[model samples]
Target: MVIKPKSLLKNKALNKWNLFWLISGPISIFMIINLLAVDTSTGAGISEMIQFSVRWAVPFVYLVIATSSVQILFPGPFSRWLMRNRKYIGLCFAVAMAWQALFIFIMSYFFHEYYYSDVYYFRDEIEGSIGYIFLPAMVLTSFNFGSKLLTPKQWKLLHTSGIYFLWAYPFSVYWWNLYYYENPVLIDYVFYWVGFVAFALRIVAWGKQRYELSKRIDPNYKTPIESKMLGGLFIIFGLLVSASGLYWQDLITSLFTCFSMVRRT
Candidate 1:
């Protein structure tokens, strides 16, 4: 009996978990507020504050949670759901980004705070140069409507390129920080490094699958074991270097303070 997947999502426990993610907004908000409160009191740098609050403490976690949930809960049906519903996700991201623009505008104008103007520009230039390109490419490939418009080979190339862009952003950020002299922290570390893991996994899977592919060797592959191992080690080193960039003590201290007070109450 092929139990319909959507029917399974209706199970009480599964429904609760879905509701949990939905309701987690409040908890995330509170956590961010607490983080901001402590940072403000402690005089943390604006960039570090924003990075911790938005990138690390919130959006990245949300991204991982949402993607992981779709994969685990929906599986096969998830693909169809994503294809049918990706526009909604894109639209939501667009709307959130638009709201961020509005917020930045208000901050720069009404509040007379221009500190983040360059930060905004830096992030925009990087993401537009990279993330924007991939997202559109993925949207095009994953959409049945767009896929039909491109030849399979063309779509495959574009889709593969998009995946590449997705992986490249972290390295771009690393270099961007060096170029701009901006410091990154653990959250930034995790975001980029975790992404590297995904990228490395894909490469490993491809290489393993093509180990004896006599009729179909990847032109990109090198036959040398040393090169392959070196590439793997580079991925590990990147993660560690990125992780080393984090503001760990500050985060741990603030988090512990918050929990300790709660426990005392």
Candidate 2:
């Protein structure tokens, strides 16, 4: 007699709110522990916690960005699972960002000079304020109550714009860290590539999608992998050059440091 192993992908209870809690509960615990380990009595401590929360929050947003692409590129049980839980995953990001918001408020109120001088930049403030605005707007519109107010096209535009903006922020952050920053952390490399690859997958999937659409439009129209292969080559060459930046730091520092993120460093 053979005993079949249980497949988690088939489990209905594992998605939705259950999935949200399962992922978020441990994240919250670690976040609290991180808070305790820090000296939160000072502005710097609160600031550090804010960065920590961002690290915690970003992975969920990555999942949100890539899940649909994952389904498009490689449809399977795991991809389906990711697709089903996308909304809940988004909720997890909102909750984590809420934590950062709390810390931001604490720092701005109690450590005004530190928050403004050390943490705030007018350009970054504008970017982040736009993000904050999109955040709650996306959250509210995720549900039926808020969603019903918008037309389907409007709703789709809101989410698509918000997710891409959200993806761009972190991807740019890590890209700057990897390409321009001094003493970039190991996690900086990890997050940069992970974000890079996730978006890359979406690009590949889009190419494949357009290829398929073209064929459907004209069955006799022949298509070659030239575009796809060329696209892949560009990605490879770009990665090699970008990865080579570490050994040639002097070139970038002189050229790009003055242009450093308006207060992002």
Candidate 3:
């Protein structure tokens, strides 16, 4: 009798573990390369390495937060997949951000003389520090056991506020760079807009849910189809924006460079 091989991807119980490895494995490899292969002889190289890590990881962070909103906006196989795997996606995001934080710590503390210039100090003092405070709180509460410590309302408030705070980091960074430094990278714009769209989607969904709840108390209240239509429009707009961003040569080059750097190292 022929026996079928067990597939790790098909195992639902191990979904979180699979996500952990999927996200962490590449990040770990990149960190190793930065430590070993990247020429950190100059402070500029170290700064570039740090920026590289942040840019690559920010998309995944946005994606994790977008999962719920995306599911609400587009109810289908893709949306269902996102909803089913949201917990793992969120955990993976925390892991990715933790990796980014480690790189920042090393840069600030160990290579302070080389990397911690005036700009770095100013940025960290103003924004990075605030962002870091929320990171640990969100990460800790991401697990089921940790979440149980807080009332459902408390948990919702913390995560909702935490994600908004974290979202500000990339938005502020890219906007500041775009306006002040004149570095018009397509990917940065994509990240900023995607973050905005995700937040907007959530707000709309929440408002609609509340309206629906209130309608239950009234006999004449009717559910509107406009919400679904609006959701569909949002999903379509998101896909179009993402596709346009992916077509940019500069963004493609940057992604390839990042991957090649890791591969070569």
- The best candidate by TM-score is 2
Off by over 4 Å in 3: 1-14, 114-118, 121-123, 214-265
lDDT of candidate 3 over 139-251, digit per residue (tens): 77877778889998999998888777777778667655554455578876777677767667787667667776778888577656996688689878866754464356467
Which candidate number maximizes lDDT?
Answer: 2
Report the C-alpha displacement of residue 121, candidate 3, in angstroms: 4.3
Worst lDDT 10-window in candidate 3: 2-11
Q: What is the per-residue lDDT of model 2 for residues 45-160, given as tens digits with 9 covering 90 to 100?
A: 99999989999988888889999999999988789888888999999999899888898889989999998888897977788888899999999999999999999999999999
TM-score of model 1 vs. true structure:
0.46
Judged by lDDT relative to the true structure, which candidate is superior, 1 or 2? Answer: 2
Q: Any runs in candidate 2 off by more than 4 Å, and if so which?
A: 1-6, 224-233, 244-265
At residue 16, give the lDDT of candidate 1: 34
Report the Cα lDDT for candidate 1. Answer: 0.51
- Rank list by lDDT: 2, 3, 1
Model 2 residue 129 lDDT?
88
